[model samples]
Target: MVSRSRTRPITGVLVSLTAAGLLAGCVPGTSGAGSSNSAGKDTVVTDPAAMGKVTLNVLDTFSGGTDNAWMTSVVNAFEKKYPNITINRTSMAWGDAMAALPLKLKSHNPPDIVPPNNGWQSMGTLVRGGLLLNLDNYADAYGWKKSFPQSILSEHQFSTDGKQMGTGSVFGTPVARASLIEVYYNRSLLKQIGAKVPTTYAEFDSALAKAKSAGITPITLGNADQNGVTQPLFSLTDAFGAQSKISDFIYSKGDTGIAQTGFPKAVSTFKQWSDKGYLTKDYAGLASADAAQSFVNGKGLFHFDYSGSLPLKAGQSKGFGSFVLPRDDGGKPVTTASAAANLSISSKTKHADAAAAFLNFAAGEQAAELAVEHGTMPLLHANVKATGGDPLFADDVAIAQSISTNGTAVPFLDWATPTLYQTINTTMQSMLAGKSTEKAVVTAAGKDATAYAKTLGN
Candidate 1:
């Protein structure tokens, strides 16, 4: 989630798997007659070393920051442990990876390991097309079901036919970090405005109003490229609605609508904040990274963003702290969150065993330790030690734990449809600019999701 300024926007163009010929053949270990390890019954590899000198071609989006360092550590650790598998990693920016992966999966030779963005465009398309191998067997073999939280694991699952998501077979495992959309507040600014850190929606609103009355920017937002608004907007939505309703709308489950969730109210709240001068005046033209930097430099009371976008390292920025946006009832926190882009295996890869081994290794204690050391949230959060000296990272881990255990974490709304990204982004910008209504945005999202659901026969 580090800002890669040059990355392209996601077009969300879903290509048909059969039309593109992406399913070249039966997935390894998935098809055969009467073999215990065949027909996908038992894929537990007792010894991956038996494969002998296999190399995994990997594509990932952890190209910068502590995330990249975590990736490097995992690969080196896996190589040292196995000593027979060589990992050839290709890392790119998030947007670049999202745009390139669909095309790459369609190639004759895709990477043995691929980073698939969650939702319909990449994960769904590849799963439906038979480009990615199901990881349920590997999960079982490695005890992943017991090690990883079901809340995190559920995001990577989809039906065999790919029409449904958030259920069915596991397709991938999160590599390094968990991402949560939360509020990063400037403690100094809050104190200066005579407002305390908020623990509920009412308190947060009071702080925002106090900051505005004190002539301080209550929030610093940058949506120039449409990437910055989602955190706050979705966090508010998560706050105002049940996670089940939000997830239903996001995954095209049942007849739930975006309007049925708190999305419309969240949008209206965002618009009200804009109208009240609680946000940066030039948010429409500012980039997300710049906005985060401005908050780190002490210009705003709060800056909402994903955990991975923290502009400064833990403890590097003085008088800065983060909190999951609280619910109105003063209950446990909830937010839009999931593991970072998950790593999936290509079904066409000849080295399925080795690739699956690498994934299992990445989800282990060693990898979790490395992830925490590099300031990223570990997938095995329950076992990993809290960061030694960095309060910021410790807070991050605590927030992630709190959400995972005590509250609900919903999926990002963009996952609702291939085109929902553009639809929401444009509509949000227009709403903030006073050119569109919240009802229009909600209605458009519902219609878009319903139309896409029909295509999937949902």
Candidate 2:
């Protein structure tokens, strides 16, 4: 599935959805209209016969196997349910979407629906430029306030001026999937190294040492494109630091949030893993997909990635299992997670009702079924069967549920600034290559975030 974070490149075969159908009914009003308490904004046109004939241009990043399959099924089901609406879908890789969406949104004819990555870089910028629609009324009409967890919904919230996040009116919705960054270990590799699945930071470190002592690669990493190192580094940060401080730093909530947190320790520990030869050799030259593939092929003891990126074959995941990054004090689980991809509506579209309908349909029962059937955990809290018969999918569901229920989930650190992605990527890459220290990484990250905050007059 396409990952929500910055490090994992979204890659997949192009899938196009086209249909020929027409039914006439009422045309929706401008921006926000039709909802009773919605201030006459946000059209709540749920009736297929009342929507009239409409076509929506949807640009998405659900490109690869299960992700692609899930999107295709959902689109097909949506069109089938509403024969009056036609979906013109365009899928692209994650990196490509990041590069192209800004320009596309500014074009004379922008797509009606776009999966904008959450944060100041994509959503905030689009909101500021008035390129994205405000979906606050839609949330009210659809009862989304109760349908989604606050942690999940907050990712899509931004102020009217687009200068603040985690607050204000709703602007979008999460992809129908749930996800988090966690550790995936090969059962056979753990057994060979005489290690067990770690339940605490101490045990996790010990297992890595044990694997290294036994001449096995403890963690497989691919950082060539700079996306591979972030997941584990953030996981380690979650383990060693207070999740609150990490959240504060990412949101730029207080003065130098990372100054007293465990971030430096986390960076140092990450460097230690590199120095102790516990990671894959020549990892900087490899891509994340390749490293994940290598882990599945039994080349590494553990792999750090988003839960949905396991790439395991159907019914063949018995040899694999996953665990959340454990707290050092054995506290409740905590990690960085939001939507796999938070979706936004384009302000330039002529069919807000139709686009909103598509988004609502994605969160319904049928789409949830498609999500589970294709190996992704659905956003709705309904109990699900095994995903594609893969046990790891069960683990994914349990992990997501656990975090949403009792554990803490925070936003990604790179969301701190528009340039923080590249800043963290290059800084972490240099540290892993022994060209930079933990302090340097911390300093660089803090500086980039501070500079961005100043521009916002924070």
> Which one is best on TM-score?
1
Task: For residues 1-458, write the lDDT of model 1, one tens digit per residue.
Answer: 24322112456334333345433322333331112112143645747678799889999887876668778988998898889899999999776676677568657798999988777766776776666787778888887776666667777888876678888788888664677677888877888878777988999999999888888999998888788888788888888877788888887777888888888889889889998888998899999888988888788889888775767754564467788888766767776777766888877678888888888877667877787777676554554766576656677777766654643677777887778877888888887788878888888878889888887779
Clashes in predicted model 2: 6
- lDDT tens readout by residue for model 2, 361-426: 886668767777776776655455455455666777777766556537877777777677677778
For residue 111, model 1's alpha carbon misses the true position, in angstroms, by 1.7
| 38 Cα displacement, candidate 2 (Å) | 12
The Cα RMSD of model 2 versus the native structure comes to: 6.8
Give per-residue lDDT, candidate 2, residue 387. Answer: 56
* Cand. 2 Cα-lDDT: 0.74
Q: Indicate which candidate wins on lDDT.
A: 1
TM-score, per-candidate, Cα-based = 0.90, 0.86
